[model samples]
Target: MFCLVLHSHLPWLANHGRWPVGEEWLYQSWAATYLPVTAVLRRLAAEGRTRLLTLGVTPVLAAQLDDPHCLNGMHHWLGNWQLRAHEAAGMPSASHRDLGAREHRASAAALDVFETRWRHGGSAVLRELIDAETIELLGGPLAHPFQPLLDPRLRAFSLSEGLADAEARWGHTPAGIWAPECGYTPGMEIGYAAAGVSHFMVDGPALRGDTTAGRPVWDSDVVAFGRDLEVSYRVWSPKTGYPGHAAYRDFHTYDHDTGLKPARVTGRTVPSEKKAPYDPELAAVAVDQHVADFVDTVRRRLRSESERIGGPALVVAAFDTELFGHWWHEGPQWLEQVLRALPEAGIEIGTLADARARGYVGAPVELQDSSWGSGKDWRVWAGDQVQDLVQLNAEVVQTALDTIDKDRDANHHGFEGDPELRKRVHDQMLRETLLTVSSDWAFMVSKDSAAGYARDRAHKHAHALREIADAVASGRDEVARRLADGWNAADGLFPALDARRLPVRSAETAAFAGSTQ
Candidate 1:
């Protein structure tokens, strides 16, 4: 049996009143992926196929999915997609008119049911699938931290809070976590063990202590599964993934005339206007071919391994869930069909937990700090453009420590009723802190995708923390109130952040290492 792990996650883009980056990203992903993916699973269940695959949906993403504001936004976005598709279908006889009609109708129907089930509280359709055992849901830390780069206490608090939130909503605590970006560092196993995580997924290289994929590896207490890069990469190979094939819709090129996304991925280097129209028949053929190639690859790898190890070998294929409906367009359909085809051809599909149950453990070893970014280094977060934010983070982190040390002791009057609020503050601080620390920001800066926006957000969060520290320092209620109000205005996602419970450190840790405060 091959274990297929789909990690679905995004940061908390809530009703924090932020835009162009935060909550909008959540709604966009929801419309493009979440609702569609769930619908796909529901259809599979109806076909009598017992859907038992592992999925890691981060708490931050789940929280937004369940948020009243986000629910409303997604409902609106889905409707807009339906209308847009409808409008596109009416345009002049473009090559993609038929495809547009089918897509528009399907999207409208799906949204109609999704809105009906998402009753302002819980996503009933998703709940139904979970109850039916079609999908195995997993949860990860709040804000999806690059764990290996996080402070020890911060890591514990984030994982603990995330797990608790999962238990509250999903009715079961996840036994495994998908480290954000598979960012693994030495000693992270201790954190996973503390969080009660029995297993976590890492890249193939992280397991072998090298990029070569010859064997599976494990830590002292946690089991690590590597993505079967050969099979997994086939669907989205570096250059010639299914998305870049000639028959499928081009993700990058959009038609400005009708506001419809109508370009096809002609061969590499072909301009958008020169490409052919998206032909569903041709795409179906491509999906079929890719599916066959993927199945054969998995079968060969597993059989070869079984021959060597004298047992039933497992290949774990992992991917970002969003890559399905959003990036690849026809990705969700391709996945559903591929899932069925693979099993029919003798390739068994299993979850991470299933692989572990079959005694697929590896030799114990420590992992190095890393991410799935370019060069797989820490430069993404700690790079030059984001240096100011890093310095600001250190400063505010120190200020938070000093506040805790000086005012928040056994006799602290503000710690009692404020724990939840304190927790909110701590969590939000951690969130912004993590966001500011995200390797993506640096990568984006390097790639030049609104670097100013990323930099501003990073520093803004740091500034908010400084204000919080100042309020605590003066014992002036008005100052704290104003700063809290400002944060509330800027970020309404976490209203319960108690300014009092923010962690405090000793004078030494509070003091700057090389720079003066």
Candidate 2:
């Protein structure tokens, strides 16, 4: 029985309004991917099937999922989809000329089924399935920071907070975490062990020198499970995956002329939608073939491994949760069918935790410092184009620490007097720090998708923190009040951010930094 762990995550996309970039991308994904995936699990569980799949919804994304604003936006978006479909179906031109119009109508009706069945507080339906042991819920750090590059103290604080948030929502802390982007280093195992995580997922390359998954990789006290590259790459490889086939829906070719998605996955930029509406039936046939091939591959691999090593063999297939329903269009259907089909084929479908329970052993090996980014290095955050932001990040982080230390030294205080004031400073500091450290800035800089926006945001938040630190250090209470008020007006989510909770930079911490600040 092989464990198939799918680590699903997106950075929190709320309130930082950037179209084609931030919060909207989040809501679209929630409607297209997260919600639908959960619904599929719910349906499978309803049929008296208990399949194990690990879903790591990051704390930031989780907060947005349950946030009232995002929920309302999702409701509106689904309803709009329904309205648009009906309106298109009713048009005489669409009815008379577009043979695909009827399909659109059917698609609309299916979406209606989705919206009505799962939109309003309906995720709890899947939550109930989780409660019933139908799925294993995984979680990760608050804000999804790239852990390896983060300060150890900040990493510990963020991961601990994430665990607490998961338990608050799901009623149990996850035994494992889907480290943001499978971002891991040898030293991070201490933080994971400290945070009570028994295991975490890693990309195959991080474990095996080559990414051909043949064995488990252990990083000190924690167990590292490698993603089965063949199975995972089949779905979404860097250059070509199942979604790149000519018959599937094209992600990038939306008809800007009509604001309707008419482009098909014609493969290699040939624009297949100009030919015809992608036949969902054909897509379903493709899904079946892919599933059969995957199942056979897993069975053969496991059988060969058992013959060689004399143990119950395991294969872990990992993927981004967004690939389903969002990119492939038929991906959710494929996933549902695959989940249902795997068991009958004698391949076990279970979460990483379950595999650990079955006693999968990690070999004594040291893991490379890596992430699932380009070049599998910290380039995504510390790349050349983003060098300025990196420097600003270091500067702002130092400023925050320096201010805290100075204030503490003078009065031996964290945040005194007003609870709300202290909270604001702490929350603002965290917010600025997170915004500064986002991998998106580096990704955008590398990808050149609104590089200016990423740069501006990083510097803006850095300046905000630096100014706040200066205000506090100078005993300029009025300036501090003004800066706090400005931040309050801009980023007001953590209204009760008690700055008092921020620990002072102790001599030990200072000793660790070697007079840097």
Candidate 1, residues 62-108, lDDT tens digits: the string is 76777777787777767776777777777677654675687687677
Winning model by lDDT:
2
TM-scores for all predictions: 0.87, 0.88
Clashes of each: 7, 5
lDDT by residue (tens digit), candidate 2, 61-142: 6666666667677777666655555555555664222533744664565566555664554345446866888878787877
Q: Measured by TM-score, how close is model 1 to the native structure?
A: 0.87
TM-score of candidate 2 relative to the true fold = 0.88
Q: What's model 1's lDDT at 9? A: 76
